[model samples]
Target chain A: MNKQTIGFAGLSHLGIIYSAASAARGFSVVAFDPRTDLTADLAHGRFPVAEPGLDDLYREHSARLTYTSDASRLAHCQLVFVALDVTTNDSNQSDLGPLEKLLAEVTPQLAHGATLVIMSQLPPGYSRKLSAKLADNKLRDNQLFYQVETLVFGNAVDRAVHPERIIIGSDKVGADKVGSDKTGSDKPGEALPAHYAAYLKAFECPTVLMRYESAELCKIAINCFLVSSIATSNTLAEVCERIGADWREIVPALRLDQRIGTKAYLTPGLGIAGGNLERDLVTVQRLAEENGCDASVVTAWQRNSMYRKDWVLGRLFASGLLQNTEQTRIGVWGLAYKQDTHSTKNSPSLALLRALNAYSCQAYDPVAKIDAGQFPHVRVCDAAEEAAQDSDVLLVMTPWREFASAPLERLLPRMRGRKVIDPYGVLAEARCRQLGYQYERLGA
Target chain B: MLQHHRSPHSPLPRTVILGAGGFLSPVLQRNLQAHGATMMALGRSTIDLTKPGASAELAAHIQPDDAVVMAAGLTPDKGKDTATLMANLRMAEAVALALQHSRPAHFLYISSDAVYDARWSSLLNEESACEPSDLYALMHVAREKILGQACQQARIPFAIVRPCAIYGPGDTHNSYGPNRFLRSALNSRTIALFGAGQERRHHVFVDDVAELVRQCIGHASTGVINAVTGHAASFGEVAEMIAALAADNIMIDHLPQSAPVTHRHFDTRALALAFPSLQATELADGLRQSYAALQPASGLAALSSASPASQKPATKKEEAVCP
Candidate 1:
């Protein structure tokens, strides 16, 4: 067994996964969260997040993991990670209050030589500000590092266990500012604590070392690239609808090109939904506004995302199905932002539902629980077909696999109307069209 | 033939390959060899996977640190019956059973895009649901599951490559895409299609699939990837592409439409993310290379004379099928 004892403070999605993965990697881990109930549940193999292989990973390595709510429990560790999932507000601005409080509580209790790595989504200068504040507590500047956490919501366990690359932003005592024009090689990771370096080496991937600001901004940079791809796909998909072309047909040609590569965000969907990407875009726009830099592209992406979010609404208006509010009984399937996630923050389904609130709406989601009081106009159904029953129109909002594989014959008999507006193409258009229903999908 | 050969990179460990006589194996073996891999290419003549006790024989061949490629199976052209399905499952069973005994560093299983539920006409990725349409597709799905479970039990790094309508020279199956188009164009100076050939399907060059396998072996990449060009072309378009390189007087015929014109598209983000350096062969360029490979020393004359295989009449099932 590895002698290193790692500590994770702030046990949210990132902390739970990384701490479990650390324990699986043979390091004894102390998972500390402020919520006592969460820690108590985690001790019994009950994870708040529903990730595949998470329950089993925690169970298999239960002997090596310790779940605690006490901040003082972190003092016994050689390396500590501030693994809080940043909370964002309506404007996509991060509320760093929880992260700030946790750091304040955990910093004074950290072992003298222990390396404190911030593994949260941070703004460009947050790490440097933290380093400056912690200097008063006698925490050595070289001992502070910021590691980018690239864990997706649904696929966190696997990514946490086997990262593609480990990007660490070490504190270069008096390095250049956030956006320096100077060019130089990245700093070496030799300043990292031996235990911390050894823990990263176990992953067997490349370790990229840079200054605190770059590492802080790296997460945002990656998300911005993804947003750009999504914007590109969404824009072209709309064009495909106008012209006699299929965006799906063009995706392959683009993917084969080396410049575009295979994994480009080529799938057209209801714009940027989840909180993280939106947060990064808003941050970029804010940074540009404050720095007096031009961010026309970012502004365009934001506008495009807002426009695309109402894709289902656009189709509904075009069809004039919602013209007679009393006659039109709309069935909306999928409330989550995306499939396999319970979060409904900025969900396009909710956006569509809100637009149709004047009309009677029935909605169903496999996992996401809808508060009955939040939308008095909508009825929450137990099953997908239940939501479709007796409705004049059915809108398959989220492309859940269950929604895709649901038998079309079942929906054919239950629905009162023949119009099916599926933005994500969850159901087969050919099948729907053959069944005497007017089926419409994105990108022609 | 215009080709871009992969340069020598870091040499790979010993690789044990099944299905040596298949069209893709030889090309894959060559590519792996170019990358300095010591290959033990096993064919049915050496170890028939459908026979009993095949697992024991395979187990004895595998060693620690060797990358094993299980590409042996009955193609749809061979037979799409339950008998063929069972035989394919048996092949996978043999490989799975062998892996349980002798663990390799990495295990790769060759699957097909047929495993994906084709009813949903959206872009498919690795995460796409595996709802097989037919027994042939189901056979691949079953084999993948069997091998995946076995690899997991043995703690072996496992990957699955599902290629969409692979076509190139030396292809024996001759699925109703580029391969059959090229053969009909050469032998009869005619390219036949079903229903105006409007159903667009993605086709990856056999060499590109081989290159992907080489990279997977080199990097020890684990997870599922679809070996596709991401470019779906209509059968008419593909026929035109092939005929452009063939004789100018070649005739194009559209037969009666038998089935619905369903299109298949792919989201190959996982493929790009896994092998960023991999360059997929363009369909037009790939067809050109395939056409050149089919040419005899005397050029199209030898094939035009109608060999016994070429003399066989095209079956109704053969011309209508699109996979």
Candidate 2:
């Protein structure tokens, strides 16, 4: 019996969770990164980041997993994954230079006939460009693959282990048939080798095998659809706010339809908040300009997101809460992009804070890293109640569990003002109104 | 919880309709929709009711407080064939079994006026004796009994609607009296009548039938109702009304009849008693409306006013009935 060793390159957010999940599924896994400190932290059983249940899984499967900074340690692996999360600059531009530099350094030391799978999210033609470089070096053409990474920030560990489906961008036909859309590509250098095929079976999920460009484009297509829906909901939600109708009551009818199921992304929110969806939109527009495909819908989504980012400021202005800026005290409950974890890339609450740079603001996030250097006058409170203390108005920006479960009957008396503007609708509006706090939400 | 998810704001129920691609089926769907009802119309293309286990598949589509209209059936003029009879029987059984399994909030079966005995010349009402005259009538008569028994046992609130001869837009049957007369007036500028235009029968507008169905479903009714205009007209009067609404140059060709002249009249007193708000459309008004709705984009009523080929009248089977 031959034991297939799986290797992951770059121990970032995408790399750490997937490596730990593969080890938990009874596969011998090896992950390597050139950063010695990050590798040392993982080798000593300290997680490089925070994800729910990630540390426990790593402890249970630590005997089968290896962490190293040496590229030669990946030579014995049949499938070596380059699973780096591409970072964005301060201008929100996708910086692919780091991923390209890492891929160049990791592909050369691989053993003969070992699959070099690029698991990082790539633009449409990036997969083809990298595969062309691998073929130029007399490497076996069948060993190149680009697998799409579908990791949402908060649910990384669970999605890594129990994926809805796996998309392998190679022309390999496995023992079990892949998804219905998997047809053989007419292009060359798209087939997967026997070793990579057997190694991917450890995920125990339905696999989709297609060409490199198709796989790369499929990931963008899914995100574009999701962003369009979110943008549409926000657009209509603004109309509902002006009119007397409630978007929350109307959305359930749409969700019950078979075309849009109960799990549809129909919530009216502060627009597309994370880096992944925005990056995909930018990538789509770039590709569309080169290919001349119609991309007006993507432009509309980006414009709507920018328009929704100023919702908090608009509400405060309309309520006359920010009129006396020198005396008015504002409390912001959460600063993370969403409810969990410490990632703040393209966080809407941070955008609101930046817009309110002239006003005195107090904010709190239980776990998210706050850069005090960005705003000099704003105070970072340790507790959520401290932020809400002596406030003319309180803004519930993020929907953390503590914000929803807090005893508002006991806490509202501490605030100086009797107004709460909650966009998330996490708090009960009726009870808040009964408690004599004037509440304002997006829709009804 | 199911009601919470069905329709949040609309007090009207979500309705599921079978055999919903036909002419009357779509009009009924539109009529109910305008009243704020959420509906799903399934045709044979969606689920072949004759197929085995299709009943179970249909049962899964129903929800609490949802209305189900079984419009699935075959008309006699589509002809006296065993396939037509058997298909209608199977659809009746499948729909009944589905109702027994799901027990929809309201069950409505689109029965026909053909269930009345043709032997009696007097106007037939809901309480009239049902005597199947042929294989086609026999099919509806058997279906009525099966559905009546199945709905009773299943504890489903069921209503049956027996509509008379219907004429309106999208009448593919192009039946003889009003549909063919309008088509003839448009295509050839001529109205072809059978045997001195003397057959006396009841004609109901397609929209009226749809309105009756909508009202029945809304009332959550459990009884039989007839869809008809209390006033019956001779074929000659219907042709004159079409000719008058059409053009000055339209001609009427009185052709020799092959069969005996039949009089089928309906007493719609029960329809008025069931719903006092119901208004039966007049013959001249219904004929004019049907004529205005049927003129094609080719200007058949305007330019092709004298074409002789348009004079050939459509068969009576093309005369209107819904399956």
Candidate 3:
């Protein structure tokens, strides 16, 4: 099982993490992408996504990993996972064209009895139909499977290495049953296909076997629960602001409740900015509408998300600091949506900048680069303090940990005015107030 | 065995029963075992169909040559709400998914007579329209379609048995039918009826339904067959029959009707055509057997003139909505 080669199609974040982790697990990995430049960059240790320890893990396991643009190379591997990060349109609907094209290229090259696992986000019923379609092409039913990927953006490496449970959707009955070995393996007591089970055994986690549709829906169910938690926090945090209560103080009590455990996404933030959450919400809404399932709650989530996206901008307009906007140079800290990665899709910082088009904005982020043409009135600064220079107001939007340790005394001299709006409470509130700055934050 | 037993047919194939915890599954399991067939009964403890990985768990136990019988479902006694319906559908989904992967040689789903249009006044057959009046019936209708489609796609021979109100010893539902009538006679010595129990419904014994399942497996049958006795007796008549069979004098009382009086009659020609030699037990005899089987051992010695030797074991049936 350890000697079996694993193949990954598509060089998205999901593909990179799984490929690197597979290599780290001591199995030879073939990571393929049709894009030659992307494959070349990967081979040269240039990754397209950033995650803590991702580069180090890849560099250390480089000897076991193969980055290639050739589909034929996957034929040598016994198990392959289609780990394409589903691309979404502006409306958050998944565009499955690339995934279909990738499957078309890779399926023909797969070895006989090679397992094909889809680890991408998919609409329900898609996997079963895909299995049928593949069966039409003479592929055995057991050859195809669906696996739910639960990788988080900033923590991809850790999640890849340490999944709480591995959910593999297979048509083969008892494929996930413990101590069951009915996969027609000649070897005694092999539950799943010997190669597939061996690959999963490397993870040393509970493996769940289910139908493709259930597994596909399980991924959406996870995102929906997360969206629900975020919506709950944002709604309650708004109520706290009016009643003189601190959301941070209430979080501890909520965490103690068994129903709402420590991992609950209770912190209120600028609505759902990343495409993943919004895409799931939209998918649910569409599924509900199509099936006549009442999804009023899903609609409410979208409304809440839209209202929360403008939290920073709404606070800015409500404050009189923007009254003399022509004379004001605003300092904006952070551009990426909630940090750790460079993606800015539907970012609240960008939304704030777009709304403050009349003013000259000075922004500095540790990584995320802004498009100059999109925000012509904004100037990208070299350092956090440099953005504060000659600025009347400062807005700490993304809660990057480094921003918490910024020198307060140095910032006081750099800033022209004393208004500090830190929605995430990243900086010290007592120090900002003692420095004679008007510190405004959500939920008191 | 009715339905033209394939002469020189192979012995009963290995049978895997899903929803073995339900009232009828165990009975069917016993019948298959009695017929010298290989049986794997998957009760809730073995594999809960509503769980996350149930499909895989169920598929693992089933073999390519196995004949699978899916008799697991929630009755109206649980609830008639959408949630219950979804739970039942989830169970069916698990079976359908498992069948797709397992690709068994034969698949049979135990459906209900409730799937027929509640408004149908004429004799119902397999071709009758399925316009279920409630969620429980709708769940069965949906399940039949789900399992039917999966079997068709997998090329597995599929059969459906939509039995009428099934009543015998060890009945769990005790719905407003013969089961309830007999239990009331024994427990309280008072048989209560809704609006004089005027609504007539077909009630088949549990054993008969199990026999149909056995024959269906033996013949590798396809298509739908109603597991009915071709007997429609009013609730009042069934109560009276139980009262006659009981050792103690059972008083019959009529309560005000909650709904309008309705009666269901099934055309069992298909059942006859499928299993030509199989016979459904007469209602009077079934009530006598049920009354005797449900009585306590000490009470059996003092039983009424209804002799056990004079009666035969009854047919197995499904649930009929109460009026």
Candidate 4:
């Protein structure tokens, strides 16, 4: 199949990575953004996000990647990716406004038989609703595909450049629906048209084709399973600490077992903080309640996550680290929920900071910036060493690779006190003990 | 006689048992009886637990000072069908509603070790990932959440007990440890083993489970605990012990090894916290007692008369249910 022009609408995080990756795969890419300033910035190779290696890839393939605010440029492409990170509410509920707005702008300019692939994390059945809306507007069958996006913040370039797998959801029944209108065809050896096959063939990654609901559900199910593992692991880690058994040792043996492999997301930490797992749980709960399915299982997942999220605060209070020290200065390293992303949305570290009674607190992130007014007492430092300077206690909230690999000997000298709470156990316990630092870590 | 510790102001504590006719019910009943405590035992036949009014009716039946033990639910079977999952979930909802309505002093849920996906390790303690493979384990996990929420909302003390491979002489479900061996040895039959029989299992006698539950009832321990033997034994060790205790002519057969089944054989230190003085029967001695108990007049004659072919060696399917 011959490659066709692929358009990317709303050049946000998802759009830039996907468009760049597509362009790198030799597809002529037309990237669109409604904001004139953003498009102008992109044209001069100014990327909005601080993703590692993304800017270099953008620079290398900027020739094949066309950045524009014009909707007419999309008409030249046969396939379009409506890529935008859906905005989440305070309750972790997603607002589909950005997605709907982009769809309204792009659908009108789409050429006949042009496939619209939605590359965003959405609620279960959201894709089916989009498919129905497209069908109601008289779009051809299989013209709309809901493809799942698996991009992580720090590793966006690698995830996009080499994804684990590509999943495509289209309503096309067989090969006959590819390029031509064969509504009444009864032939056995017919092939889908090149135009339709080209949309699927454009992806160099292995594609999983399923129905709309299944594809939408696939994302939620995976997240739910992952969250369940996290919650269970956290629960066990707490038990392990109380029983004086190292959960770290237990987790490896569990991982080696084929039924519970190492990749089951069973790592114990300060619970789930990022938006992906939380959004999926809430989505499943909402949809289950709406459809009258037994949602109690998902609700448990949510409750467990909430309980585990407060684990750091619970540990700090229980350990007496925050007691008798009203004016204690606590240094926290890594503000993002997990390593490698600048996003602090529903971050567990920030939540822990909010619950701390200490009057003076310092925080540092590799890429994330804290709003001055949001955290009145938190002083945002430039680096990890600066954050630990003159601090009564050090709390390693996020397990960013830099902080994990930082020389503890150099950083520990700056702090006044010896208490270091590393939720991820970034520093070796034996080494920390040798340095005479009072160290506490999760699942130790 | 055991000394009783009572609160000065409160009245005598009462307790209610759901699924009172189960394998652990008799021991629980005897323990409660020994304490001279007021208690009520309800079986599924007495109340259709899946119905909407079941909880309300049960709450109305029990007094205010009473606690509720939700031990009633579908056990894992060969089919591991959807109906079993739905039934267990309904049972949980009913128990949660009852606890919510009655505002019990304590809500004790008897969960299973099967909730932990066996793939992780053999000696899973209280803290382990709940990776349930079949619907049975899934249902138990789901129930743990439903009841946990109800207890939280009602401000009642809640305790979840996840027992590992419970076995003893009274287990009519010949699938449990002692009964399976006794039945196989008495009939001079070969015991079909899954895997290399090297996968270890931490088996808790039924009486120990009863003691743990009684301790939780009396002490109001409000978290999850693993009710299991501290020691783990492989199937081969168990079979050899049982064979030696038999009529001396019984043959032990090894079946072709299949893929290992992942299960949580617990480390019961948390349980020991509540019942520090509780004694567990040694595996060999327990097998001997089980063999002796299976004598002709001990009422296991019917089981013994049933051929080994009828017994089917208690496959992994039977393992889902308690031994």
lDDT by residue (A194-265, candidate 3, tens digit) is 788778777867676666767777888899999999999998898898689999999999999999999899
**What DockQ would you assign to candidate 1?**
0.01
Best by DockQ: 4
- What digit string (tens of lDDT, one per residue) describes model 3 on residues B262-311? 88987654654455446677788877777776656624322222332232
lDDT by residue for model 2 (B1-323), tens = 00012222236667787876555777776787788778887777677888898889888888767888877766654556888888888888888888888887878888788888766636577877788777777888888888878889988777888888887755545557787788778777899988788877788888889888877776676788888876678999888888889756889998889888878876544554455345666777877767766556523243224333232222212112222
Stretches of candidate 1 off by over 4 Å are A173-187, B1-323
RMSD of 3: 27.0
lDDT assessment of candidate 1: 0.81
Note the chain A TM-score of all models in turn: 0.94, 0.93, 0.95, 0.91
- Measured on C-alpha atoms, candidate 2 has an lDDT of 0.77
Find the 10 residues in a row with the least total lDDT in model 2 chain B.
Answer: B1-10
- Chain A TM-score, cand. 4: 0.91
- Tell me the tens digit of each residue's lDDT in model 4 across A323-415: 444556889898887787778888888887666523578999988877888798899999999999999778888888787778888889899
TM-score of 1: 0.56
What CA root-mean-square deviation does each model show from the true structure? 26.0, 25.5, 27.0, 14.7
Q: Which residue pairs come into collision in candidate 4?
A: A179-A193, A236-B127, A254-B120, B118-B262, B118-B263, B176-B323
Candidate 1 shows a clash count of 2
- Kindly report which residue stretches of model 3 are placed more than 4 angstroms away from their true locations once superposed: A174-191, B1-323
Alpha carbon lDDT of each predicted model: 0.81, 0.77, 0.81, 0.73
Tens-digit per-residue lDDT, B71-97, candidate 4:
876565323699778877887888788
